[model samples]
Target: EDSIVPAAMYEPLVKAFGDAKNQVSLFKDIVLKLPRDNRATLLLMIDFIILVATNQGNQMDMSGMVTALSSCLLRPPRHLQERISAASNVFAIIMFFATNRGTFFAPEVSSLTQFLPPDDPALHQPYSNDKAEQPQQTQQTLQTLQTQQTQQPQQPQQSQPK
Candidate 1:
Protein backbone atom coordinates (compact mmCIF):
# COMPACT_ATOMS: atom_id res chain seq x y z
CA GLU A 1 0.00 0.00 0.00
CA ASP A 2 2.95 2.32 0.42
CA SER A 3 3.23 2.97 -3.31
CA ILE A 4 -0.36 2.67 -4.54
CA VAL A 5 -2.08 4.25 -1.55
CA PRO A 6 0.35 7.13 -1.21
CA ALA A 7 0.17 7.60 -4.98
CA ALA A 8 -3.50 8.42 -4.52
CA MET A 9 -3.18 10.52 -1.40
CA TYR A 10 -0.33 12.86 -2.36
CA GLU A 11 -2.51 14.55 -4.98
CA PRO A 12 -4.35 16.52 -2.35
CA LEU A 13 -1.67 16.84 0.28
CA VAL A 14 1.39 17.75 -1.83
CA LYS A 15 1.38 21.33 -0.55
CA ALA A 16 1.95 20.05 2.96
CA PHE A 17 4.32 17.14 2.41
CA GLY A 18 5.46 17.39 -1.18
CA ASP A 19 9.02 16.19 -1.46
CA ALA A 20 9.93 19.13 -3.70
CA LYS A 21 9.28 21.59 -0.91
CA ASN A 22 10.36 19.39 1.99
CA GLN A 23 13.44 18.47 -0.05
CA VAL A 24 12.65 14.94 1.01
CA SER A 25 14.04 15.71 4.45
CA LEU A 26 12.39 12.61 5.81
CA PHE A 27 14.22 10.40 3.34
CA LYS A 28 17.53 12.15 3.81
CA ASP A 29 17.31 12.25 7.58
CA ILE A 30 15.91 8.79 8.22
CA VAL A 31 15.79 6.52 5.19
CA LEU A 32 19.25 7.21 3.78
CA LYS A 33 20.82 6.40 7.11
CA LEU A 34 19.07 3.06 7.23
CA PRO A 35 20.49 -0.21 5.90
CA ARG A 36 20.32 -1.24 2.26
CA ASP A 37 17.21 -3.39 2.47
CA ASN A 38 15.44 -0.71 4.43
CA ARG A 39 16.42 1.96 1.90
CA ALA A 40 14.74 -0.06 -0.82
CA THR A 41 11.39 0.24 0.91
CA LEU A 42 11.75 3.95 1.49
CA LEU A 43 13.00 4.61 -2.03
CA LEU A 44 9.76 3.10 -3.20
CA MET A 45 7.87 5.68 -1.20
CA ILE A 46 9.34 8.39 -3.43
CA ASP A 47 8.26 6.47 -6.48
CA PHE A 48 4.73 6.74 -5.16
CA ILE A 49 5.13 10.48 -5.03
CA ILE A 50 6.38 10.57 -8.61
CA LEU A 51 3.67 8.32 -9.99
CA VAL A 52 0.90 10.05 -8.11
CA ALA A 53 1.98 13.58 -8.81
CA THR A 54 2.07 12.83 -12.51
CA ASN A 55 -0.97 10.62 -13.03
CA GLN A 56 -3.27 12.46 -10.67
CA GLY A 57 -3.13 15.75 -12.63
CA ASN A 58 -1.85 17.28 -9.40
CA GLN A 59 0.60 19.62 -11.27
CA MET A 60 3.13 19.43 -8.46
CA ASP A 61 6.74 20.45 -8.98
CA MET A 62 8.94 17.34 -8.93
CA SER A 63 12.35 18.92 -8.43
CA GLY A 64 12.64 17.78 -4.80
CA MET A 65 11.56 14.31 -5.66
CA VAL A 66 14.06 14.19 -8.50
CA THR A 67 16.85 15.50 -6.32
CA ALA A 68 16.08 12.99 -3.62
CA LEU A 69 16.14 10.18 -6.18
CA SER A 70 19.40 11.37 -7.77
CA SER A 71 21.02 11.38 -4.33
CA CYS A 72 19.73 7.91 -3.62
CA LEU A 73 21.20 6.68 -6.89
CA LEU A 74 24.46 8.61 -6.87
CA ARG A 75 25.36 8.33 -3.16
CA PRO A 76 27.92 5.94 -1.85
CA PRO A 77 28.05 2.30 -1.01
CA ARG A 78 28.56 2.34 -4.79
CA HIS A 79 27.50 -1.28 -4.82
CA LEU A 80 23.86 -0.27 -5.08
CA GLN A 81 24.48 2.60 -7.50
CA GLU A 82 23.65 0.60 -10.60
CA ARG A 83 20.37 -0.70 -9.21
CA ILE A 84 19.43 2.74 -7.98
CA SER A 85 20.26 4.33 -11.33
CA ALA A 86 18.12 1.76 -13.10
CA ALA A 87 15.19 2.27 -10.77
CA SER A 88 15.52 6.03 -11.11
CA ASN A 89 15.46 5.66 -14.87
CA VAL A 90 12.20 3.80 -14.56
CA PHE A 91 10.90 6.48 -12.24
CA ALA A 92 11.95 9.19 -14.72
CA ILE A 93 10.18 7.59 -17.65
CA ILE A 94 7.01 7.06 -15.68
CA MET A 95 7.03 10.63 -14.43
CA PHE A 96 7.77 12.07 -17.87
CA PHE A 97 4.93 10.28 -19.59
CA ALA A 98 2.50 10.87 -16.79
CA THR A 99 3.21 14.58 -16.85
CA ASN A 100 3.48 15.08 -20.60
CA ARG A 101 0.86 12.96 -22.23
CA GLY A 102 1.92 13.69 -25.81
CA THR A 103 4.23 16.38 -26.95
CA PHE A 104 6.10 13.95 -29.22
CA PHE A 105 4.56 10.57 -28.58
CA ALA A 106 1.39 8.66 -28.00
CA PRO A 107 0.72 5.06 -26.97
CA GLU A 108 0.75 4.32 -30.69
CA VAL A 109 4.43 5.25 -30.93
CA SER A 110 5.18 1.78 -29.50
CA SER A 111 8.78 2.79 -28.95
CA LEU A 112 9.79 2.68 -25.32
CA THR A 113 12.67 5.14 -25.64
CA GLN A 114 10.22 7.84 -26.64
CA PHE A 115 9.55 8.23 -22.94
CA LEU A 116 13.16 8.62 -21.86
CA PRO A 117 14.36 11.55 -19.72
CA PRO A 118 14.39 15.00 -21.32
CA ASP A 119 18.18 15.10 -21.23
CA ASP A 120 18.97 11.59 -22.37
CA PRO A 121 21.28 11.62 -25.41
CA ALA A 122 19.38 8.73 -26.89
CA LEU A 123 16.51 11.14 -27.37
CA HIS A 124 18.47 12.81 -30.13
CA GLN A 125 19.39 9.58 -31.88
CA PRO A 126 17.21 7.95 -34.47
CA TYR A 127 15.45 4.81 -33.25
CA SER A 128 15.09 1.54 -35.07
CA ASN A 129 13.88 -1.93 -34.18
CA ASP A 130 17.41 -3.34 -34.61
CA LYS A 131 18.73 -0.91 -32.00
CA ALA A 132 15.98 -1.58 -29.53
CA GLU A 133 17.77 -4.50 -27.83
CA GLN A 134 21.41 -3.46 -28.24
CA PRO A 135 22.70 -5.48 -25.31
CA GLN A 136 22.70 -8.70 -27.33
CA GLN A 137 26.21 -9.83 -26.39
CA THR A 138 25.12 -11.54 -23.19
CA GLN A 139 22.22 -13.32 -24.80
CA GLN A 140 24.35 -14.39 -27.74
CA THR A 141 27.00 -15.71 -25.36
CA LEU A 142 24.39 -17.70 -23.50
CA GLN A 143 23.08 -19.19 -26.73
CA THR A 144 26.60 -20.17 -27.76
CA LEU A 145 27.15 -21.84 -24.40
CA GLN A 146 23.92 -23.80 -24.74
CA THR A 147 24.84 -24.94 -28.22
CA GLN A 148 28.26 -26.10 -27.01
CA GLN A 149 26.66 -27.98 -24.12
CA THR A 150 24.27 -29.83 -26.45
CA GLN A 151 26.80 -30.66 -29.18
CA GLN A 152 29.56 -32.17 -27.04
CA PRO A 153 29.72 -35.91 -26.94
CA GLN A 154 29.60 -37.50 -23.49
CA GLN A 155 32.06 -40.15 -22.41
CA PRO A 156 30.99 -43.12 -20.30
CA GLN A 157 31.58 -42.46 -16.64
CA GLN A 158 34.32 -44.51 -15.00
CA SER A 159 33.46 -45.98 -11.65
CA GLN A 160 35.81 -44.96 -8.83
CA PRO A 161 37.88 -47.74 -7.39
CA LYS A 162 36.82 -48.61 -3.89
Candidate 2:
Protein backbone atom coordinates (compact mmCIF):
# COMPACT_ATOMS: atom_id res chain seq x y z
CA GLU A 1 0.00 0.00 0.00
CA ASP A 2 2.83 2.39 0.77
CA SER A 3 4.47 1.82 -2.56
CA ILE A 4 1.23 2.15 -4.43
CA VAL A 5 0.18 5.13 -2.44
CA PRO A 6 3.31 7.17 -3.21
CA ALA A 7 3.68 6.10 -6.78
CA ALA A 8 0.06 6.35 -7.73
CA MET A 9 -1.75 8.68 -5.37
CA TYR A 10 0.86 10.95 -3.81
CA GLU A 11 2.58 11.79 -7.09
CA PRO A 12 -0.63 13.13 -8.54
CA LEU A 13 -1.24 15.19 -5.45
CA VAL A 14 2.25 16.65 -5.61
CA LYS A 15 1.79 17.47 -9.25
CA ALA A 16 -1.50 19.18 -8.56
CA PHE A 17 0.14 21.14 -5.80
CA GLY A 18 2.85 22.27 -8.15
CA ASP A 19 0.32 23.75 -10.52
CA ALA A 20 -0.03 27.48 -10.01
CA LYS A 21 -3.64 27.80 -11.00
CA ASN A 22 -5.32 25.84 -8.22
CA GLN A 23 -2.51 24.76 -5.96
CA VAL A 24 -3.89 26.20 -2.72
CA SER A 25 -7.28 24.57 -2.95
CA LEU A 26 -5.74 21.35 -4.23
CA PHE A 27 -3.28 21.28 -1.35
CA LYS A 28 -6.17 21.71 1.08
CA ASP A 29 -7.93 18.73 -0.45
CA ILE A 30 -4.81 16.62 -0.31
CA VAL A 31 -4.27 17.53 3.33
CA LEU A 32 -7.79 16.54 4.20
CA LYS A 33 -7.42 13.17 2.50
CA LEU A 34 -3.96 12.36 3.82
CA PRO A 35 -3.76 9.45 6.26
CA ARG A 36 -3.00 10.64 9.78
CA ASP A 37 0.08 8.42 10.25
CA ASN A 38 1.49 8.86 6.77
CA ARG A 39 4.87 10.56 6.59
CA ALA A 40 4.13 11.76 3.09
CA THR A 41 1.54 14.10 4.53
CA LEU A 42 4.22 15.87 6.49
CA LEU A 43 6.48 16.07 3.46
CA LEU A 44 3.67 17.39 1.32
CA MET A 45 2.79 20.00 3.90
CA ILE A 46 6.40 21.20 4.00
CA ASP A 47 6.63 21.27 0.23
CA PHE A 48 3.40 23.23 -0.11
CA ILE A 49 4.43 25.70 2.54
CA ILE A 50 7.77 26.20 0.82
CA LEU A 51 6.09 26.55 -2.51
CA VAL A 52 3.74 29.25 -1.30
CA ALA A 53 6.48 31.05 0.53
CA THR A 54 8.86 31.01 -2.44
CA ASN A 55 6.28 31.80 -5.11
CA GLN A 56 5.03 34.92 -3.39
CA GLY A 57 5.15 37.97 -5.73
CA ASN A 58 4.83 35.68 -8.68
CA GLN A 59 1.90 33.30 -9.01
CA MET A 60 1.57 33.24 -5.20
CA ASP A 61 1.29 36.07 -2.68
CA MET A 62 4.23 36.35 -0.30
CA SER A 63 2.72 39.04 1.97
CA GLY A 64 4.83 37.96 5.00
CA MET A 65 6.15 34.93 6.89
CA VAL A 66 3.30 35.02 9.41
CA THR A 67 0.82 33.75 6.86
CA ALA A 68 2.71 30.52 6.32
CA LEU A 69 3.19 30.01 10.05
CA SER A 70 -0.44 30.73 10.72
CA SER A 71 -1.55 28.24 8.08
CA CYS A 72 0.50 25.50 9.73
CA LEU A 73 -0.76 26.47 13.17
CA LEU A 74 -4.34 26.35 11.95
CA ARG A 75 -3.99 22.76 10.75
CA PRO A 76 -5.88 20.11 12.65
CA PRO A 77 -4.23 18.34 15.60
CA ARG A 78 -1.65 19.98 17.85
CA HIS A 79 0.85 17.25 17.03
CA LEU A 80 1.04 18.31 13.40
CA GLN A 81 1.57 21.95 14.36
CA GLU A 82 4.38 20.93 16.72
CA ARG A 83 5.95 18.79 13.99
CA ILE A 84 5.86 21.66 11.52
CA SER A 85 7.29 24.05 14.11
CA ALA A 86 10.22 21.70 14.68
CA ALA A 87 10.67 21.36 10.95
CA SER A 88 10.73 25.16 10.65
CA ASN A 89 13.57 25.40 13.17
CA VAL A 90 15.54 22.75 11.32
CA PHE A 91 14.97 24.58 8.08
CA ALA A 92 16.04 27.89 9.61
CA ILE A 93 19.33 26.42 10.83
CA ILE A 94 19.98 24.75 7.49
CA MET A 95 19.23 27.94 5.57
CA PHE A 96 21.47 30.01 7.84
CA PHE A 97 24.39 27.70 7.02
CA ALA A 98 23.56 27.75 3.34
CA THR A 99 23.33 31.54 3.29
CA ASN A 100 26.72 31.91 4.97
CA ARG A 101 28.20 29.75 2.22
CA GLY A 102 26.70 32.06 -0.45
CA THR A 103 24.25 29.43 -1.56
CA PHE A 104 20.47 29.62 -1.59
CA PHE A 105 18.91 27.12 0.80
CA ALA A 106 15.40 28.36 0.03
CA PRO A 107 13.75 31.58 -1.06
CA GLU A 108 11.36 31.83 1.86
CA VAL A 109 13.21 32.69 5.03
CA SER A 110 11.46 36.03 5.45
CA SER A 111 8.07 34.45 5.12
CA LEU A 112 9.02 31.73 7.59
CA THR A 113 10.08 34.31 10.13
CA GLN A 114 6.81 36.16 9.68
CA PHE A 115 4.86 33.00 10.39
CA LEU A 116 6.74 32.36 13.62
CA PRO A 117 5.17 33.90 16.70
CA PRO A 118 7.07 36.45 18.80
CA ASP A 119 6.27 34.53 21.99
CA ASP A 120 8.24 31.58 20.70
CA PRO A 121 11.04 31.97 23.25
CA ALA A 122 13.02 29.20 21.58
CA LEU A 123 13.07 31.18 18.37
CA HIS A 124 14.10 34.56 19.80
CA GLN A 125 15.08 35.39 23.36
CA PRO A 126 13.42 38.29 25.13
CA TYR A 127 15.52 41.06 26.63
CA SER A 128 16.15 40.95 30.39
CA ASN A 129 13.65 43.06 32.35
CA ASP A 130 16.22 45.61 33.44
CA LYS A 131 17.65 45.87 29.95
CA ALA A 132 14.22 46.24 28.44
CA GLU A 133 13.35 49.07 30.80
CA GLN A 134 16.56 51.01 30.21
CA PRO A 135 15.17 53.13 27.36
CA GLN A 136 12.21 54.37 29.41
CA GLN A 137 14.48 55.00 32.37
CA THR A 138 16.79 57.14 30.24
CA GLN A 139 13.85 59.14 28.89
CA GLN A 140 12.66 59.86 32.41
CA THR A 141 16.13 61.03 33.46
CA LEU A 142 16.25 63.42 30.50
CA GLN A 143 12.84 64.84 31.41
CA THR A 144 13.94 65.37 35.01
CA LEU A 145 17.04 67.25 33.89
CA GLN A 146 14.95 69.53 31.63
CA THR A 147 12.51 70.25 34.49
CA GLN A 148 15.38 71.17 36.86
CA GLN A 149 16.81 73.54 34.27
CA THR A 150 13.42 75.25 33.77
CA GLN A 151 12.69 75.61 37.52
CA GLN A 152 16.03 77.19 38.49
CA PRO A 153 15.74 81.02 38.52
CA GLN A 154 18.66 82.86 37.00
CA GLN A 155 20.27 85.25 39.53
CA PRO A 156 20.09 88.98 38.42
CA GLN A 157 23.46 90.62 38.22
CA GLN A 158 23.75 93.40 40.89
CA SER A 159 24.03 96.91 39.41
CA GLN A 160 27.55 98.18 39.64
CA PRO A 161 27.80 100.83 42.49
CA LYS A 162 29.34 104.01 41.23
Candidate 3:
Protein backbone atom coordinates (compact mmCIF):
# COMPACT_ATOMS: atom_id res chain seq x y z
CA GLU A 1 0.00 0.00 0.00
CA ASP A 2 1.72 2.97 -1.21
CA SER A 3 -0.84 5.77 -1.40
CA ILE A 4 0.79 7.23 -4.49
CA VAL A 5 1.70 4.81 -7.21
CA PRO A 6 5.11 5.91 -8.45
CA ALA A 7 5.23 7.90 -11.69
CA ALA A 8 8.68 6.47 -12.30
CA MET A 9 7.03 3.08 -12.77
CA TYR A 10 4.51 4.35 -15.36
CA GLU A 11 6.07 7.26 -17.32
CA PRO A 12 8.84 5.09 -18.79
CA LEU A 13 6.27 2.68 -20.18
CA VAL A 14 4.26 5.59 -21.54
CA LYS A 15 7.38 6.96 -23.24
CA ALA A 16 8.23 3.47 -24.44
CA PHE A 17 4.88 3.20 -26.18
CA GLY A 18 5.54 6.46 -28.02
CA ASP A 19 9.24 5.96 -28.75
CA ALA A 20 9.98 2.25 -28.69
CA LYS A 21 9.44 0.43 -31.97
CA ASN A 22 8.65 -2.76 -30.04
CA GLN A 23 6.40 -1.27 -27.41
CA VAL A 24 5.43 -4.58 -25.77
CA SER A 25 9.03 -5.62 -25.21
CA LEU A 26 9.87 -2.19 -23.87
CA PHE A 27 6.84 -2.36 -21.59
CA LYS A 28 7.95 -5.73 -20.27
CA ASP A 29 11.49 -4.45 -19.72
CA ILE A 30 10.16 -1.59 -17.63
CA VAL A 31 7.83 -3.83 -15.65
CA LEU A 32 10.29 -6.66 -14.96
CA LYS A 33 12.63 -4.11 -13.39
CA LEU A 34 10.21 -3.59 -10.52
CA PRO A 35 10.88 -5.44 -7.25
CA ARG A 36 9.35 -8.90 -7.06
CA ASP A 37 6.68 -7.87 -4.58
CA ASN A 38 5.76 -4.81 -6.56
CA ARG A 39 5.43 -6.89 -9.69
CA ALA A 40 3.21 -9.40 -7.90
CA THR A 41 1.08 -6.66 -6.39
CA LEU A 42 0.59 -4.99 -9.74
CA LEU A 43 -0.27 -8.19 -11.55
CA LEU A 44 -2.56 -9.38 -8.79
CA MET A 45 -4.56 -6.18 -8.91
CA ILE A 46 -4.88 -6.40 -12.67
CA ASP A 47 -5.93 -10.03 -12.42
CA PHE A 48 -8.58 -9.23 -9.86
CA ILE A 49 -9.94 -6.48 -12.03
CA ILE A 50 -10.01 -8.86 -14.97
CA LEU A 51 -11.93 -11.44 -12.98
CA VAL A 52 -14.52 -8.96 -11.79
CA ALA A 53 -14.93 -7.46 -15.23
CA THR A 54 -15.31 -10.87 -16.83
CA ASN A 55 -18.14 -11.92 -14.53
CA GLN A 56 -19.78 -8.51 -14.67
CA GLY A 57 -19.32 -7.87 -18.34
CA ASN A 58 -22.87 -6.62 -18.81
CA GLN A 59 -22.31 -3.89 -16.25
CA MET A 60 -18.57 -3.16 -16.51
CA ASP A 61 -16.42 -4.56 -19.28
CA MET A 62 -12.65 -4.77 -19.39
CA SER A 63 -12.31 -1.33 -20.96
CA GLY A 64 -14.51 0.21 -18.29
CA MET A 65 -12.50 -1.45 -15.54
CA VAL A 66 -9.28 -0.18 -17.05
CA THR A 67 -10.67 3.32 -17.32
CA ALA A 68 -11.83 3.30 -13.71
CA LEU A 69 -8.79 1.57 -12.19
CA SER A 70 -5.76 3.07 -13.96
CA SER A 71 -5.70 6.26 -11.90
CA CYS A 72 -5.90 4.25 -8.68
CA LEU A 73 -3.03 1.99 -9.75
CA LEU A 74 -0.55 4.41 -11.38
CA ARG A 75 0.40 8.00 -10.78
CA PRO A 76 1.75 10.07 -13.65
CA PRO A 77 4.66 12.51 -13.39
CA ARG A 78 4.57 15.98 -11.81
CA HIS A 79 5.14 18.32 -14.74
CA LEU A 80 1.88 19.92 -15.84
CA GLN A 81 2.46 19.66 -19.57
CA GLU A 82 3.96 16.19 -19.35
CA ARG A 83 1.12 15.07 -17.11
CA ILE A 84 -1.46 16.25 -19.63
CA SER A 85 0.53 14.83 -22.55
CA ALA A 86 1.07 11.45 -20.89
CA ALA A 87 -2.58 10.92 -19.84
CA SER A 88 -3.64 9.23 -23.05
CA ASN A 89 -0.54 7.04 -23.14
CA VAL A 90 -1.19 6.03 -19.55
CA PHE A 91 -4.76 5.04 -20.50
CA ALA A 92 -3.37 3.17 -23.51
CA ILE A 93 -0.89 1.24 -21.40
CA ILE A 94 -3.58 0.28 -18.93
CA MET A 95 -5.82 -0.80 -21.77
CA PHE A 96 -2.96 -2.76 -23.26
CA PHE A 97 -2.09 -4.43 -19.99
CA ALA A 98 -5.66 -5.41 -19.20
CA THR A 99 -6.22 -6.69 -22.72
CA ASN A 100 -2.97 -8.64 -22.80
CA ARG A 101 -3.02 -9.57 -19.09
CA GLY A 102 0.73 -9.49 -18.48
CA THR A 103 1.28 -12.03 -21.24
CA PHE A 104 4.50 -10.33 -22.31
CA PHE A 105 6.01 -10.82 -18.89
CA ALA A 106 5.68 -14.62 -18.88
CA PRO A 107 8.08 -16.26 -21.25
CA GLU A 108 6.70 -19.73 -20.64
CA VAL A 109 3.19 -19.00 -21.78
CA SER A 110 1.96 -18.01 -25.25
CA SER A 111 0.89 -14.38 -25.44
CA LEU A 112 -2.83 -13.86 -25.94
CA THR A 113 -2.66 -10.92 -28.29
CA GLN A 114 -6.38 -10.51 -28.94
CA PHE A 115 -8.22 -7.21 -28.36
CA LEU A 116 -4.90 -5.38 -28.42
CA PRO A 117 -5.19 -1.63 -28.97
CA PRO A 118 -3.36 0.08 -31.80
CA ASP A 119 0.40 0.45 -31.39
CA ASP A 120 0.15 4.09 -32.43
CA PRO A 121 0.05 6.16 -29.22
CA ALA A 122 -1.75 9.02 -30.91
CA LEU A 123 -4.88 6.86 -31.31
CA HIS A 124 -5.26 6.34 -27.61
CA GLN A 125 -7.92 8.52 -26.07
CA PRO A 126 -9.50 8.64 -22.63
CA TYR A 127 -12.37 6.18 -22.34
CA SER A 128 -15.72 7.70 -23.27
CA ASN A 129 -19.15 6.27 -22.42
CA ASP A 130 -19.89 6.18 -26.15
CA LYS A 131 -18.04 2.84 -25.96
CA ALA A 132 -19.98 1.68 -22.90
CA GLU A 133 -23.01 -0.61 -22.94
CA GLN A 134 -25.35 2.13 -21.68
CA PRO A 135 -24.13 5.41 -23.07
CA GLN A 136 -27.32 7.40 -22.45
CA GLN A 137 -27.54 6.32 -18.81
CA THR A 138 -23.90 7.11 -18.20
CA GLN A 139 -24.27 10.52 -19.81
CA GLN A 140 -27.29 11.27 -17.65
CA THR A 141 -25.39 10.26 -14.50
CA LEU A 142 -22.47 12.47 -15.47
CA GLN A 143 -24.80 15.38 -16.18
CA THR A 144 -26.47 14.87 -12.82
CA LEU A 145 -23.08 15.03 -11.10
CA GLN A 146 -22.18 18.25 -12.92
CA THR A 147 -25.51 19.80 -12.08
CA GLN A 148 -25.22 18.90 -8.38
CA GLN A 149 -21.69 20.25 -8.16
CA THR A 150 -22.70 23.56 -9.71
CA GLN A 151 -26.10 24.03 -8.05
CA GLN A 152 -25.61 22.72 -4.50
CA PRO A 153 -24.49 25.14 -1.77
CA GLN A 154 -21.40 24.27 0.25
CA GLN A 155 -21.98 22.96 3.76
CA PRO A 156 -20.76 25.10 6.62
CA GLN A 157 -17.91 23.55 8.58
CA GLN A 158 -18.55 22.82 12.25
CA SER A 159 -15.88 23.49 14.89
CA GLN A 160 -14.03 20.45 16.15
CA PRO A 161 -15.12 19.09 19.50
CA LYS A 162 -12.71 19.60 22.40
Output the number of the TM-score-best candidate: 3
lDDT of 3 by residue, 1-162 (tens): 451235566556656777757787777777667654455556666776677788943588887777787767666666633753435755677677777864644534212221223583423544333556577788899999999999989989999999
After superposition, the stretches of candidate 1 with alpha carbons farther than 4 Å from their true spots are 1-27, 56-141, 144-162
What candidate 3 gets wrong by more than 4 Å, as runs, is 1-5, 56-58, 80-87, 105-162
RMSD of 2: 15.2
Model 3 global lDDT (CA atoms, 0 to 1): 0.62
TM-score of candidate 1 versus the correct structure, residues matched by position: 0.22
Q: Write the residue-wise lDDT of candidate 2 on 46-150 in tens digits.
A: 445556657746554433333444334233234333433434533442232222211321244332232234575533743253877888999999999999999
Please tell me which model should have the higher lDDT, number 2 or number 3.
Answer: 3
The weakest ten consecutive residues by lDDT in model 2 span 97-106
Per-model C-alpha lDDT, please?
Answer: 0.45, 0.43, 0.62
lDDT by residue for model 1 (16-132), tens: 233556534432333224444333443344445556556656655465455445443333233433543435543553344234434323435424343445786766877555774
What lDDT would candidate 1 get against the real structure? 0.45
Full ranking by lDDT? 3, 1, 2
Number of backbone-clashing residue pairs for each candidate, in the order shown: 0, 5, 0
